[model samples]
Structures are given as structure tokens and as C-alpha cells.
Target: MPETAVADTATGVPLKELAARHGLASSGRLLGPVEYARQLWGYRHFITAHAKAKTVSTLGTTNLGTLWQVLTPAINALVYYIIFGVIIGTGANTTNFVPYLCIGVFVFGFTQATVSQGVNSITGNLGLIRALHFPRASLPLSAALVEIRNFITAMGVLLIIVLITGEPVNLQWLLILPAMVLQAMFNMGMAMGGARLGSKMRDIKQLIPFIMRFWMYASAVLYPVTRFTDHLHGWKLHLVEANPMLVFVELYRHSLMENVTLAGSPRLLWTEAVIWAVVVCGAGFLYFWRGEKGYGRG
Candidate 1:
């Protein structure tokens, strides 16, 4: 009998009567702040569940699934040690280059895995993307989480190597905690950006491996960044000095092996590294977020 009443076409019931029966106002303000907060909280829970499910599925798919995460990096370190440390003698001059190489390789693996796997992550799961309605960014985030777990396991191996090789432990080792968090954030950002681009272009996926290989060489995983900086002068030296990966590798090496002071006057290189980390990560996240809806369609 009320003027606000409206009939439901399908059920032939009055809309206002139905709302009153259900204890909800049919024409209430659309998604006010309180409702919006509830929606966001639900989204957060869904994302967490999705991420956990993906991680567990990955581990379940293979017999040695998670262990391979640790094994792969350790095996890589051993191979490099044999070739560079024993046979080639490249690491001979540096004190405890074994741990140095191990840490670099271990950390680098995390970055490489996220970048390489993420490039194909969206495209590879195109079927699922079409069938399911979910956050596309979660694919890259899930992949990064898997790599992060692997990195943690590899780090444990690195600590054992450090102790076995008789490297001194100090408060500086705590610095690695922040360093790892920064690196993981940076890698996730890159993965998200790359995944979006790779999904559309497809050609971008092909180029990722070559890009990663070049990055590996540039990052000084096998040797020191000083090798490049010492030889080149002025702007040439500055270019190599500006590499962000080198900064991360150097920070890890300095903190874990050298136990050097992390705080001091910020050098130009350090300042550049900080800037790149922020810029790449911030811009990449925005770039990926903008393309979120597009991913579900294709």
C-alpha cells in the first residue's frame, strides 16, 4: 500500500515488503563507508585464501616440490663454486667468496624465478582467468610468495655455509631481514608489471629470459660490482655503479660476509639504488592495478 513499494517482476512480490521482511532498506545509500570497509575486508580474506591455495597446490603437484626450491639454489651454488672457485680460480682473491657467491646466487634466484615465471603466469593461466572471477594480480603475487618461501629455505642453507666456513656472526646479520623484505617487495612489483605486459604482448615473455641472463651478469652474482667500477672511469663507471641489483647483492654480501657498517653518508650509488627501488616498485604496482579488469577478459 506504500508509495515506495515496487513489485518484483519475477516473484510478483512487493520489493519494499521483501526488504522490510529481510531487515534491510531497499533504497539505502549505495555502499557507504561502512559497507565499503566490509567489502574490502572480505576481499582481503579471499586474496589470502587464494594465495594459500595456490601455494599448496604447487607443493602438492610434485613429489619433491618444495624441497626442490632449496635444492635448486644449493646445486647452483655448488656448480658455480666448482667452476669459478676451484677450476677457474676466479674467486681465489676474495676472502670467503664461497659464501659470497652462495648468497648472491641464492638471492638472485628469487628475483629471477619471480620475473621469469611471472612473465608467463597470466598467459599460462588464461583458461582459469576466463573461467574464474578473481584478482589477476594474485597470480603474480602467488608466484612471488612461492619464490619467497624458496628464498627463506635457501637462506637457511647459506647460514649453515657461513657457520661451517667459520664466518663471524654479528648484529649486522639482522640487517638482512630488512634487505630481504625490500628485495621481495621490489621483485613482486616487477613481476606484476611484467605479467600484465607479457599477457597482452606475448612477445614480452620470450624476451624475459635474455633480459634475466643479462641482469644476472650485470648484478655481479659470480664476481663483484667493483670489478666493473674499478676498470671504468667517470660516467662509464657511474652506469655500472647505478645498477640496483648490484646494490642489493652488495648489501647482502656486506651484511652477511663483511659485517660492515650499513649506515653512513649516503653515496650517489646508494641514493640511486634507493630511488630505483621506490620508483620501479611504485610505478609497477600502479601499472598492474590499472590493468586488473582487462586480465579477466583475456
Candidate 2:
């Protein structure tokens, strides 16, 4: 019964090997991708439940409650409309600018919230991290889920705005289903990635708001994509063209508004959407898993 002895009486399997099989032992090393996924799946209920509870508590203090979810983005759209659409005239040249602006705002709102919340996911839930034995990723995954819930609710308002602006409901509107699925996958990845980084560097959380603001502007939330292309050239323009957020925004605008035209071909944008979704989500899941043991301690 030496501490280092490998022998176990009952199974005659080496104690170390038995521990490894059960995942009770390791090289004090990163978990493999498959193993990490298994762990996450085991806690799926915790993730969903936590996300739902957080959503409720988030609105608990407000008199209007969940109504704020839709209102906040609507109010944001109005402010941007006044400044970018009316004052600076960024939306003037665009056809059906209100619908165009609404789609952009609503869609970008999800991405912006996903990343910002992800950055705080781990740090914001330090008490849970310190106290719980479950996967740390549940924190960020739940954060993304909360935003997803908000996005779904806000989308109803977006559809209304598009209809009020005279967008015909067509087969194209169905495209929102796939577009949202892809974007959600991407946000999950981005959120998990941000969660891992934020846990280690708390200062990064403070900078996320400014970063998301710049990202919203760059994603053409309140302005036309033409604003970026008008003065830019070479790969610089292509960089803007291929931005993941821009791809998502264009997808939303195209699906919801007949008057709007996408900057890239639909096929190409769909391909890019699939690529970014898989790449970000797969990579983010793996990255978060790799740091499995370090979260609570660090």
C-alpha cells in the first residue's frame, strides 16, 4: 500500500491506469478535446439552468423587467439614427434605412453582448467558480445563452420594424433561421474564448466595452457598408468585407429587407459563415477545455 504503488487488489489493474480511465488521475496536464467535451456535456443542465436563472435575475431589479431587453437595443438604434442617420447622414444614401439600421443594430447587438458578457463570465462569477466543481465553461456558455434569449425576443421587434418599413415577407425571411444558428455557434466560441482569457487577465474585462463599441462601428451597425469601402482599397477593403460581424450583419439585412443588397455573394457569405462558426466554436471549446484545472485556482 505504498503511496506510489500501482497495484490495486480487486481488479489487479494498476491503480494509476484505473484512475486514468476514470479521469481521476492525469499528468496534471490539459484535458484532451474529447474528454473536455464529455465533461461539458455532463454539465449541460447546469449550463442551461444557470443561463435561465441569470436572465431572470438580470431583470429582477427593473420595473419593466424583460421589456428592457428589447427597449435597450431600440433606444440604441434611435440614438444611432439621430447621430449617424440624421446628423452625419450615413444612412441617407441607403434605401429603406430604418429597416436596414434595425437589422444591423439587432444582429450586432448579439455579438457585442456575447463578447462583452463572455469577458465577464468567469470573473463575474468568481464565487461560483471558487465553490463549484463543474466545468468552468458553463459560466460563459450560460452568458451566451442569456444573450441568445434576449436576441430572440428582440428579433420579434426587428421583424415588426422591417414590416413597418414595408419589407415583404418572403422565402428570404426564412434564411434568418440558419443565419442565427451559425451566429450562435460563433458567439459560443467567441464567448468561451473570451471567458478563458478574461479569467487570467481581469483588466481585459474593463477594455471590452470600448472594444465592442469600435467593433459595432466597424461592423456597420448604424452606417452603410459603403462607408468603409468608399475611401479604402486593396486587401484593406477585403478585410472589412470579410469581417465576421459584417458577414452576419449583411446576412441579416439581406434576409429581412428586399431593398437592401449584400456586399458579398450569398453563397460566399454562407460559406464564410460556416467556416467562422466551426473554427471559432471548435477552437474556443478546445481552448477553454485546455485550462480546465486552472480556472478556480487562478
Best by TM-score: 2
| Estimated TM-score for each candidate | 0.80, 0.93
Whole-model Cα lDDT per candidate? 0.75, 0.88
lDDT by residue (72-147, candidate 2, tens digit) is: 9999888888888888888778999998888898899898899999989988888888776777888999999999
Worst 10 residues of 2 by lDDT: 23-32
For 1-298, candidate 1 gives per-residue lDDT tens digits of: 7666578899988987887788786332334434543544556766566666766787779988778767888999999889877898777667778888888888888899889877877887888788876556767776777678778888898888877887888897887897787788788788889889988898987788799889988877887555774577878766775677777777777668764222122354346556776787777767776776678463
Deviation of model 1 at 104, angstroms: 1.0
Per-residue lDDT for 119 in model 1? 81
Provide C-alpha RMSD values for all models, in order.
5.9, 2.5
TM match of model 2 to true structure: 0.93
Which segments of model 1 are wrong by more than 4 Å? 1-42, 259-273
